[model samples]
Target: MHKKETNLSHSKLANNMMNYINKNIDTDINIDAIAVEYGLSKFHFHRIFKEQIGKNIYETIKSIRLQKASNLLITNKYSTITEIASMCGYSSQTSFIRAFKNRFEQTPTLWRNGGYKEYSNNILHNSISSDVSHTSFSHLEAKIIKTKRKKLYYIRHQGYNKELSKVWQKMMAWVYTNNIENYEQIAIYHDNPIITLQEDCHYIACVKVDDKTKLTNTNLPYFEIEEHLCAAFEVEGIYGDILKFIQWVYHYWLPSSGFETTTFPSFSVFEKNHFLNDDGIFKVIYYVPVRYV
Candidate 1:
């Protein structure tokens, strides 16, 4: 195979593996099974995954699990530590506590009760000031609704900032080239920016695709957003406002609303994409998947 084709093949495989791990995060993940599914020997799969993804498969899984745990500790306050542990795939509370501590340097209880502030503050260089309050969302009320399943063709981008404009540009180019006119533009936030470093957050730029769309020529990755019960809010804001809104959703609104967040990532359906606009303004319907606590 040509060098470009080989690289694309490797990236596709890595993306598939990541999706598989995330979907089955609460179950046992056998390396051998993954290797077999990909039609590669164990050693070859390990080498290729590390080379393409910059992390070994095991490291990726652990990082994803710990990230999920961190979000759960803060958002699902009503859930017990044992339940949270089990939700993150730890069989025993003891093991979960140990792993959580190793990753976040705090016990689950402490994290749930505000230890995450210190961790987040450290990562963001203490930018999470006391003045950054949740009052910004006080005037906006969320409507509870159930969303339909959606299939998306997406390009994954790491980091969250103004630079995302470039990713959107590329995505739009693809959309125009493919003559896909009927679609909703979406952005998936795979990490809590408050806890994860800004430059390390996982962001996906996606366009919802239907049966009418022709995708036989493109190499973009695809993932499905399953139907979810959500608290939906319409937001019109500038560059950093969305991040603050997300923080408010988990820290303020959710706790008081008598709801707990699910494992699925929150996403936004853009009426006006902030990244693409020169004014840096965005109009979106943000959806936070939830269930009654």
Candidate 2:
């Protein structure tokens, strides 16, 4: 195979492994089994994955599982420690707590009872950097469109502190450190803060990349964004007001425009200087997955 095809193949395999781990997060995973499923020898799989993903396969699995459990805890979905432990695939609650503490430096209960603030602030909680009250959507262009698939490289953030200022700061620093200024910066909201509890909301500070871009060395979790038919809108507002505009699209614009939301989550594509700008206002295009009713 040529150099380009080889790179693409390795990237595809890495992505597949990530998806498999996420799907089986609540179950005991076997590295040998994963190697077999991906049609590679266990030793070979281990080496390439570590090189391309920047973490051992099992290490990545634990990280993802912990992040998921953290989300479940803040959301208050499971009532008891035992339940959360079992749900996260721990055979014993004590073992789960030990592992959780080892990774996050806090017990499960402490982490859930507003203890997450030590690691995360509620920057995403009921805050606005600029007002959009006078902003007019009439001047912006919006329409329904189908988006293509995209592979996103992102750093996972937990709790309510998706504060764009801090989030972007870390992202940009990482970029400069790694010297990857060519990639596209994008943010992914994993849960709806409006409906989900404030502490349970998840966000990722991300950039778009292709097969040619090295991922594992970047030290961020990567995922694929599936193609979707969506109701797209262009708006200019403070970074914090993104949710506000989404509410506008869902509650008013979508309903009146004869479209219903699809199952996929919505996302925004930001313009230059729109995110974390000096004026605190961002130019963005929002995409809410939708279907014609």
lDDT per residue for candidate 1 within 1-293, as digits (tens), equals: 99989988998888778778878888778989879988999999999988877789998888778888888888887899898888878889999899889988889899889898778767656444222434377889999999998988888887786678999999998888888879899999988887777777789899986777776458787878789999999998777778878878877788778888877889999999988888877899999989986
Q: Could you say which candidate leads in lDDT?
A: 1
Report the backbone clash tally of model 1.
Answer: 0
lDDT at residue 111 of model 1 (Cα atoms): 89
Off by over 4 Å in 2: 1-141, 159-162, 197-199, 214-216, 273-275
Which 10 residues in a row give candidate 2 its minimum summed lDDT?
123-132
TM-score list, all predictions: 0.93, 0.53
Those runs of model 1 whose alpha carbons end farther than 4 Å from true positions after fitting are: 124-135
Backbone clashes for every candidate come to: 0, 2
Best prediction by TM-score? 1
